[model samples]
Target: METLATTEIEEDVDRISHLPDFIIHNILSRIGLWDWIRGGKEHHSQLLRLSVLSKKWFNLTASFPYLIFRIDHFHNVSRLNFFKYVEYATSRFCHHHNHVTAHTFKLSTTLREPAELDIVIKCVELVLNKGVRVLSIDILSVLGVQRYRLPNILSTVSMLESLAINGCYLPSSFMVNALQFKSLIRLKLQYISIDDEVIKYLNTSCPLLQDLEIRRCNGFKIVCVTGHQNLQNVTIAHNTQVERIHIEAPNLSELWLDERRTMQMNLVSCKKLRKVTYFGDLLPNSNSGFLSNFPFVDTLMLDTKCNNLKLSSHSLRTLVLLSNYDLEDIEFRTPNLASMYSRKYLFTMQPSVVSDSTHLKASMHCNPYGYIDATWFQKLRQFLDKKNGLEVLNLHIRTTCSLEKRDLEKLKAIELPPYELEHVQLQLDTQEESSAHRNFVDAVFWCCRPRSLILKSSSPLIDFEEQSDIVKFTHEKLLEQEDQSRTKIQIVPSSSCEAQIHLSDLKSLSKALPSAEQIIKFIKEEA
Candidate 1:
């Protein structure tokens, strides 16, 4: 065994050593901008170790074009040693490749006092002098002093293509114009404050800016994007103090606004806008004129209180509506709409689209009293029947409590339609165990008649044994009906607020179809 292991190790090392230098450099060059930074300090250490492996590996790793310097990793080391280590690493990396330029550089540091902030500023200056196309700086003021300011030298990085800054204060004398940021295409600012002047510069100047994202920021109460030809996508989210927004970008294709605090908005002239997501609570007071400016919008999402939704966008292809209260009436004149997701209105309303098929996803909020009445099923059938072109249906039922066997029996006996459903998903409270809700599972399966059934519980404690009975019962019931053997059943455990489920759990159960230990191993691996 020892001889075999030694031979295998030698073969593996020989295989790697035979790879060409160009192939290795190509692999390293494709490492994404954020991937190296995601590993923190350990990633840089690994690269240093790789450089010492062999002569060829050393040369390839030394010319590495992307680097991230996270100084917080040295918080435990002596200050003198930390500076010496950084100086050695940076000098070695920056001075080795006289011809090759670093494409991306990221710096993350904590500034507890003036001295630390100054050191970080100097480090940024040094990396800038090395010439990088993409730069991201994440500076945190650990003492909450907020004294660290972005240096004015950033404006001189003429070759910069993308810039991102988080948790750093912009100086009051900050000035951005076309000449300063001409090459920048993408800009992201999070947890940073910028005033009206910067907002104006972003809208009128910076012609090459195509994609912009601003999250959890302040310093301006209004955002106006008008008359920009190159800008394509814009996203502004989670700004609590912003009260108003105005957009008149004729060339903009997509816009996303998710600010609950913004009370007013105007999309004056978005003639080429294709998609929009509006998530705000101040819809009742929304300007009707602003809502009418979306004649060319293809996809839209609105969380509004308007009882009557009259959308006349001929190009509208997708629509999603989320509202606290049920809408009384809705009207869509979109001829090309292919999919829609929304809460079912109190009364059945028909859309005026003329598509051959439409994919529909509906959400149902079950009553806390655990009432799954026949009327609810009748209404669903009526809604589906009125929409003749519905090729697929997905139901997301959010139940509040556990259900017993009787509830499943009632659902099985309901006069449900024979229409085929694509998928059915249930969300129950976390405290509700899977073993006690077999009836609820059966009811969803029988009532929806879905091609595939997904059984999800809020509790992670759900085991394979807990769902075996339901699986067996479903199989027995399906066998009683002809041509139902192809239906699929899947089990997943997820929290009420989450949608992700690990596939390993299902794989373990499938390998040993009727065993409890497999499920136990799955859960243990999860823990």
Candidate 2:
């Protein structure tokens, strides 16, 4: 019987191996082995293991068309051995698919010696010769090591569509000609030092370019992106040395700027802009409303320090407010807004919404240092008011101290208006004693009446025994109010399905409940 079963499994494997090349490739791609955006060392190893099944599988893996090599993947091997492995692997692939046009090739490693750098350049040239369209080379820089200089041979590849270079230095002569990047559509440069002239060259050279990103790069003071009618998305973030940015892309739709320092921005012609993310002090200093420049923007994310900020936009749909420490008041006049997320240190106030939309989902993350008082609950009630018609509310409360009995009394003394939500989730991170857990639950219930309360731990380091005690206390408290409120408690266990059981059933399955780490893992997976 064992021999018969083994023969059947081998026969099934043989049948799958005889499939057409396109069918096999499609099957492998479904596992994310050939995806440029998904594959990693694990996927590569899985592909190699699959190749050992048969010669047809080996050939298919060699001609996979998407290749990625990273030295960090081989941490147990020496640097020289890693390079030799790369050379041997690439040589085998190139030999098998001599005339095939590779779709993408990515190499990420650190080079301490000049010979290693030369070998990397050679590998890049070899990929280009194979007509690889998408090339990404991320050379990590050591503290005292010289930065890698981008070889000029890349400029000769007119068929390249997407190119990404990190931790490299681009000389002035590189990409100087306008005819170099004729087919390039996407370009990303990070941790690079390139002059302003090279940027100007790309601005005029790559007419078909649609996406451009320059992050944490230096040696360029002013960025003037103009005359690219096809450009749609532009991101310039964390480049503190950039003093001025002037963009005139008529077809541009998305722009993201995350600079710590103040800078001048001219986006007068970006009328088609639909989303804008600004993270700096540029908003408070602007003479006019910064959002007025892009009237068509539907999504906006702001991380700045402003006291009384007012946003009035007709096309706004989504808003994300992050790290606004000095924010006191916010007035929104977005009639079409549908979703809003506010993540900050503390919540002293909520945005005053003057919209006609009845459907809105709001999520908030509040990190309080010492303790949560009644005033915080009052502000939270104002934020989650019934007038907003919020469909769901996800609240993450992370506090360093526990709630006292007096705080709980004060919270209960303040009568909050009745507002029932469709779904309410509370992620708690506190160091309160097991006795104070009941007071914390009472304070939370006083703020809002949630039909279903989803409870989970916010911090992974929380003691499992203590967290289990908290959960048990919360279950008992909710059961005491079950007759009056009919609220159901949803406890998300780590390895099992979400059990929405009553406190009366705790004795029957108390040992089966998840630990703190399991709850955190489940929360992350859900997120």
Candidate 3:
């Protein structure tokens, strides 16, 4: 036994001697710290065990980054453990250089007071002192006297490009006194008061700012900027004074407005805007009237729960509306249905009513209450003319509650023009009709022969990427659980609201979808 153990030791020594010190160091340095942290909780012991392999391995693995020390989990992880993890990670990555450039720490808790905030600040300082590029803190309120948390984080990180804070309170924050922020590109703040002072400070302090997201925030007179063409997103929410926002971001493509407190949408500016989402109670009062002048249209998401919608756009192709489908109010119009975007409206019916898009594709969403007469579906089919045209379509169908058999059957029987439809979807309440709904999807597929088919039940969304990243993360986490009951995809279902979902379906054939002319023949043959 002693001879056997001695032989094994000699073999291990021979393996270690084959590699130079620099090669061992390089191998250790290449270990991605974030991957280990996110992979699973079981990796903790494995990471530690790797350090015990050999002295060279120990030196390398001990110094590499292995986790993101988020302060929000401090309660669960003691200060001793957090520092230990950090020390272990920093030692591995910054052993020779004394600093790294990729270290990251995230926090999602309200710093109750300076004492509590100081602990986290010290943690940040410890990591930033070494090196950090990205940091996210979800602060309910900065309850500390150390006001310039913003400047502290902004100034400290030399390579920081992304920063985020949740529930920002300016009156209670120390960042109000921050004079100027250095190089920054992406900034996200939810419910963070961007009063005139904050806006002015950002306009001057962070000149190179690019991406900005402010959710549920109030007190905005006007958010007018001239520079920052790289600005891709500018989201403002929960305010009544958005009437004077003069956007100058030539590169901006996504804009979100949540007007729960006020009513004012005048779309005369913003030439580069491509995506627009509006929420809150917008009853179209004098203060917040409907938009009449939109330069163009791109993607529009309307939350009808707030009872406001804008369907006017020359470039409008993708339209999403989140409304209750329980009420029987149904008014759908596509005047620009043929030319580049469809400019004329006609009540004429072709030999058949099922229409398809010959020109640009259309995306629509309907969430409401009550039964829509088959006439609306009839009109839609006629406009589509699937026999002679090709179209790309996406739809989300949802109801507040269950639907009666008659109403459900009507929804299932809905159809579009054949051959022209390239994409189709159905977002339905899974409880009321899961098995029977397959036929509805099948019929549309038979007609349109779409390339992709999305069948979502009990909700209104169809596309996976269309949902919020945070929501996506949550759903993924639920799916990871061992318990199957919690992993199901059935959420809230209601019947009080109207449901309008653009039926999306998948193609059955692997061959490329035929051209319009070829599709016409293909449809005739298939029929």
Q: Which candidate has the highest TM-score of all?
A: 2
Worst 10 residues of 1 by lDDT: 518-527
Candidate 2 C-alpha lDDT tens digits along 294-334: 77888888887666666777787777878553223556666
Q: Give Cα-based local distance difference scores for all models.
A: 0.59, 0.68, 0.47
| Model 3 C-alpha lDDT per residue in residues 54-146, reported as the tens digit of each score | 555655544443235554444456545554555555445544545334435565454445655555555555555666656676655444354
Q: Give the lDDT ranking, best first.
A: 2, 1, 3
Per-residue lDDT tens digits of candidate 1, residues 120-192?
6666666677777898888778766555677776766777889889998864445554336778889889998
Q: Looking at candidate 3, what is the lDDT of residue 308?
A: 26
TM-score of each prediction: 0.60, 0.63, 0.54
Using lDDT as the measure, the top candidate is 2
TM-score of 1: 0.60
Backbone clash pairs for candidate 2 read none
